[model samples]
Target: MFDHIADAVKLPDLVRIGDNLVVARFETMKVYSALAAVEHLLNTGAVQPGDTLMDSSSGTYAYSLALACHKYGMKCHIVCSTKADPSVVTQLELLGATVEQVPIPPGPMVDKMDLEVRLQRINEILAARRDVYWMQQYHNGFHYHGYREVAALIDREMPGAPLTVVGGVGSGASTGGLATYLRELRPDVELVGIQPYESVTFGSEPVEDPVASISGIGSPVYFANVTYELYDRIHWIAHDQAVAATLALYRDHGIFGGMSSGCCYLAAEWEARQNPDRQFLFIGADTGHRYMSSVYTKHDQAVSLTGLEPRGIRELTELELPWAVMDWNRRPYEVAPKVLPC
Candidate 1:
């Protein structure tokens, strides 16, 4: 395993969605490192088969978990931020799961907040009165084990192949866990992590082409698992490049995906040109339709695109994690308490 990582390398494990289209196709789901870990947990009695599932999401993770819970006869109680699209909330509820939209985050991305921060203060308030389970994506000192199973899957499906893995980060579960597995299987393989320039970190830098628009990969919470030691290189994709990739996937391969996946593919293509013989795998986190109101429309892109307003370049390290903040609401709640349960 150590032999392959000679040049700032990573273990390759990329989970993909079929067609990578803007339209959502629940039926064509495929688990990469995360799902593989989740499935194994289910099989080994590590993850108990329960009557319910609870987790926070932006959109794609919620849908993925909701579908998984439903298949296993488990009800899903999703506590999502207000930024998640309404269609996603409606879909989960219609699928027999209860949806709780968390209000009062200062911005569009609330999941980025740390569990130790002020928003978590509100969460404690809700959990105090409610009966829902707190599905801590990470347990103890371990990154989410969901990526472990994904690693096993990669080992079986792709043996001895030099892979270029690309995807976003959230709980750092997918990034840390999968990287762990890939390194174990083939130490020489490279693992490349991706992030938006607007929210840069260890593996990223800001791009001036467009403003950040995608979701699911970047976060305020830093995981112990996604270490500099585990990664080969971190690349920053501009929001415009991401959008162009999304449109290209739709126009060329007929895959309609969010700008985030476009970032992944853009990275993949970049890697491929550098190593044409190597197989590059990428995670298509979600469809673009969820972003139709944002990246898909021309007027939306024009008004909000990078060139329009022109935000300056940022280092991934400079962007703040939402939880890095000390308070959730310094001012009084304008809308009286909604009396939400956990």
Candidate 2:
């Protein structure tokens, strides 16, 4: 019975954004990946039944890990950012997982330093326990393998068309792994990566991104999973741009996706316009229900969509599009593994 619930997590609803754009809304994609990781460890005898599974997540992955532990009768301890959604935190606790919420430092954007602080807390927890296994999402290649099924679904659903896969680059498992698998079948399929304005993923000079209302899409630190070569191009979407696109998606398509989804949607929209014949596919990482308080309820629906007048959907591509564009070959940041204490 629990196995069925675990299995159901992988299948997400695919929705159309426009004529040439589609979003694979992974309302619980992280759950699928997290469960896969834990099961792999258990089956391989890498971890025992009573052992605790630990990791740091912003929100979605924390819920995923907690659910996985609950299904498998294992202990789960999560070190998450204070920015994590309250609803997600409540769910994690209700699932019987212990959570430690680390306070984020005052900054316009979340950066490597913030992640380092979280890592410090996680390390502290790990140091206290001998039977804990860290499902390091950013560096774990196992995380990449879980997404092969996602690529298969995309291929099975949309076969035989020039395709461009686009998504926000977080752990690189979702976007990088999907692109890697898809390319194995169709080498010509284009891969585009999206990040927030302050993210260094595409080598944009780090700045305080006051507008980054979303988490999970952009990283302050360089992660090993984000293979720079896997992408054809990268675009940096601003916080306001993401917010505008997110609200527009809800109003126009009735798709209530998170900010990262909006960022990918905006990029996919641009890519679709550039190549009308090709299908632009992007990942809707999660739903916006968790963001209702800060994102939806706080803003005026009418003004949120129309306030950015000159920079509205009409000028999305021309003006409000990528703050910076980088070809994969010419990216500024060195793609190397971050040396962490964990």
Candidate 3:
């Protein structure tokens, strides 16, 4: 008697942002948008319910997967680093999912099966369970170009303004696929690939110590999606600068966001200042509420994500942060493409 709930990314309104000035209103569409796309991919006569989903992430998406699993009563085995935000973890548990904590230190090389290996390890864990649906955002070439839908909408909404898109990645799907789509629509567009100070797997890498500030993007190793074919230029953001920028946005604009989002937002600000005629556009992957112990919160609280990444610095706020939580920007992230398993 009622309409069934479909995926999140497919809805026309969900794919585009209506507001330009206020961020909160604009971000509402992102969760459903990403989910819709992911679900559509699954519905392609391939995936089904009751299959275990193995997703590894250091941020909010892992939790989102847990909730998505609830709809089909699928088992969710999430791989998270010691460095992963606590709020992300809490939500997964609430959805009756399991979280495996990575144990290790940086750089010695994490075995894809090592608990500390995060997504790489989740790939291994699900290997033993044939019924497990391992969804890697990487190998799946069928990118919905969710960003393109948003970008075109933004361009149309704000005419006479140049659109500059910037962000970092490990899966590199957003950077590559979105760039390809936007360039087709607006050849003069500038798609900026933001990398951390260290891991420049693609593009002309910046000169800096280690170079990568974000763990997922700028990986020391080349990821499946981060190919050379996808970008106009590369911009590097310092870890501290991204942290500072995120804090500044929270203080000034009251926009609580994650690291990659922070990088894109700062780059957008720089673009807006450089080309006043352009209306800068960027992606906000998730809310910063998940990051209470780190850059998203106070300053100087201690926490661990895993050995492959740095330990988090705690914020000094007296607020008791939950180990994990979920809000709007939550969605699934795959290290590889999400394809169906028999």
Candidate 4:
């Protein structure tokens, strides 16, 4: 029934794991956003079918955009992060995408600098080539449009129940887009965002994780598309705990997902236990193959989730290691001034 693999991959499996927990597991979740964005550009004449689409990504978005381009007859060029998986790069190249990785900087604590360099390189490319269109996945509103259909599906499946949607606050589009559309159908939809330590998105910059860059979940750059008002609560997960949760998800439910998925699962499980009256649905953004060596191989080292508990805090200043959660209350917060070099 689907014309392309991209169409088929975008469909998620909604599986109920507990009395109150449901997971919307995706193979590559961002394909929906990329496909919809590309189609819109073509339909509106903003971009022609043969045009080259460019963007900076760590992994999932790169693959997603390449798949979209292959489906729609557009060309894709990705400025990849230093942390991008080798398997992903191979796939992107095979799918006809031109990839250029920003070099890993010298010394420790290179996460923030690497991101800045990627954006700077993107600008250089834009300056040299007028024909190439930058998708600006992090700042573009078009990325949000793709999740409307997903919201409708969730609405129909879990009708008239108090629902809490949880996922990583990556570009802010995934969870933000879902909450935006879901609220239209039924107000009072609670939104929970999972973040990694040291990400500035939720003011966790004060605490730096030595592990640093957990690709696809946290970022060193500021994203314009992350609507601060959409989040009702936020959880900052540490890298070690994420690894444990990732292994646990496979062991417990046979769901092989990435670290971001583990972060969401860990947070959602706790949230579901806290609010038994509300039906909790968490987004599993991608599969675990990309993290086989980085995360899964450390299964023996992973700690038991039974002894772990997040310290609930009233303010961002109280955030600390292992895990922390705060009530954002769907309130808007000012984006901090950018101090990273451009």
Give each model a TM-score: 0.66, 0.87, 0.69, 0.97
Best by lDDT: 4
Candidate 3 structure quality by residue, lDDT tens digits, 1-342: 313232432232212222332132232233332354446646784566666777656554465456556655667777777766666677678778888887756564342333335655666776666777665554455443455665565556545555656556556776565557777777666666666643435321223443234654565444566655456555555666666666766666666677666666666565555566655566666666655666755544323222212212232121111111111111233322322211
How many pairs in model 3 have backbone atoms within 3 A of each other, for residues 3 or more apart or on separate chains, i.e. clashes? 45
Q: In model 2, what are the clashing residue pairs, if there are any?
A: 211-239
The Cα RMSD of model 4 versus the native structure comes to 1.4
Candidate 1 stretches greater than 4 Å from native: 1-52, 105-118, 125-131, 138-144, 152-161, 200-210, 299-342
Model 1 over residues 1-342: C-alpha lDDT tens digits?
332111111123233433221111222132232244345556766556664557666466566666656566566777767667888789888777777665654654433442224346446745774544444453322335545655676667766557656666544566566667777887755666666644433433233223443455554344333454555655655555567677766665666667666666656655665665666667665567777866677634432222321122333334332111111111211211321122
lDDT of 4 by residue, 169-246 (tens): 989889999999999999979999999887777888779876655667767667888899999999999888899999
Better model by TM-score, 3 or 4? Answer: 4
For candidate 3, give the lDDT of residue 186.
76
In TM-score terms, candidate 2 sits at 0.87
RMSD of each: 11.0, 4.2, 10.7, 1.4
lDDT for residue 307 in candidate 4, whole number 0-100: 73
lDDT of 3 at 29: 32
RMSD of 2: 4.2
TM-score, prediction 1: 0.66
Query: What is the descending lDDT order?
Result: 4, 2, 3, 1
